[model samples]
Target: MGDVEIRPARSEEYAAAGEVTVRAYDVDGHLAGDVGYDTVLRDVARRAEQAEVLVAVDGAGEVVGTVTVVLPGSDFAEISRPGELEFRMLAVAPTARGRGIGEALTKAVLDRARTLGIPKVVLSSLEGMRGAHRLYERLGFARLPERDWRPFPHISLIAYQIDV
Candidate 1:
């Protein structure tokens, strides 16, 4: 991860970060049969307005991965409680996979939570995203099965949380 830098995305980089996010999800088949969510994934600027939009940039400064960090009560936050920070749309470009960009970005979120004096960080992931599930587990996130939910008839999201 030495060549990657995780930081809050700049206004000028919103389009690039959004494209990286959309491309990652599209490549991973996470968007199949899902219509409108793609628009949400591509709206980094709007999310940045209400949440923190963080990007992983390679040494040359290309946005290769992005994640949205939502605080309690934000429109982008789904399952987060008052003391928890929720992250959404965690994505790493297919071409940039295996480079630890996703893990680094997630760690950055955890660091952000600690910096804000937040106790826990939470997130929702599709049940089929086994790779991400493994990563979350490796980072000590426990499943909150009782919080699992379906936003749309075809979409089922599982929750996870880790105390920071």
Candidate 2:
């Protein structure tokens, strides 16, 4: 964990970026047999066209993490609206855990929201991702209970937001 560079993902890194995402969820047991969603996680190239795809790279120039910053009307956006930006598919390589990669990637999204003059930033996290919840809360994102939702019957997504 040395000199992590937070920046937009290069076109060539899209495939590796997708692997980082899918692998993180798979490792954490979050990839619950949802073929469509799993396929979506592997489509960072497609996501890049609809939103800003940011990556956390190590000193060795390896992609260790990624997150998609989605604007209000982007296809990946869920809880965001006018004056708000939402981030999705945050993932950090399992081998890179404890290196602050996830936090750095999240801050990149927050930074983007600030630069865009957005009033708020929003995101949805799977309820089972307690570790992610801690990081989100530590970064000042408060739970937005009313925005909680479920895309799948058994998988609940909890919302969080922060005024920027």
Candidate 3:
């Protein structure tokens, strides 16, 4: 959060934000296989319409990171319950790694939930995303093994939660 601004994404920055997301995931090998997940990842404008899309903009006005906050009623609320908030699609540009942008984006989501009086936050991550898992753990989110599930034949998602 230092020199970077974390706020709702402006319409004009949607394309940049989307590319950051796609690049982050692709660089991490999260998109090695096959489907059209990148298509969804690149649809920042649609995500902004359905949920709160937050972007981390660097001092030079570049989108360095992005995440989507899914409230209970939003279609993006995959594992979110009535009183819980869920954050999804957290991505920091490959060039921005180690700058704490991902952690800042996550904390911003937690702050949003607290502001809305939500008590808990939940999220699902691809099983191989160890870096993201470590971040969530450092933020006090615990694994909810019972809630883990497979959304597609080849895709397994693990669940994590924290009380805000």
| Alpha-carbon local distance difference test for all models | 0.93, 0.92, 0.94
Tell me the TM-score of model 3: 0.98
For residues 57-138, what per-residue lDDT tens digits would candidate 2 score against the true structure? Answer: 8888888999999999778888888999999999999999998989888888888989989989999999999999999999
Off by over 4 Å in 1: none
What candidate 3 gets wrong by more than 4 Å, as runs, is none
Per-residue lDDT tens digits for candidate 1, residues 78-160, read 99999999999999989999999889999999999999999999999998899999999998999999999999989999999
For each of the candidates, give the backbone clash count. Answer: 0, 0, 0
Q: What is the lDDT, from 0 to 100, of the residue 40 in candidate 2?
A: 94
Q: Which stretches of candidate 2 lie above 4 Å from their native place?
A: none
Ranking by lDDT: 3, 1, 2
What C-alpha lDDT, on a 0 to 100 scale, does residue 74 get in candidate 2? 73
TM-score of each: 0.98, 0.97, 0.98
Candidate 3 achieves a global lDDT of 0.94
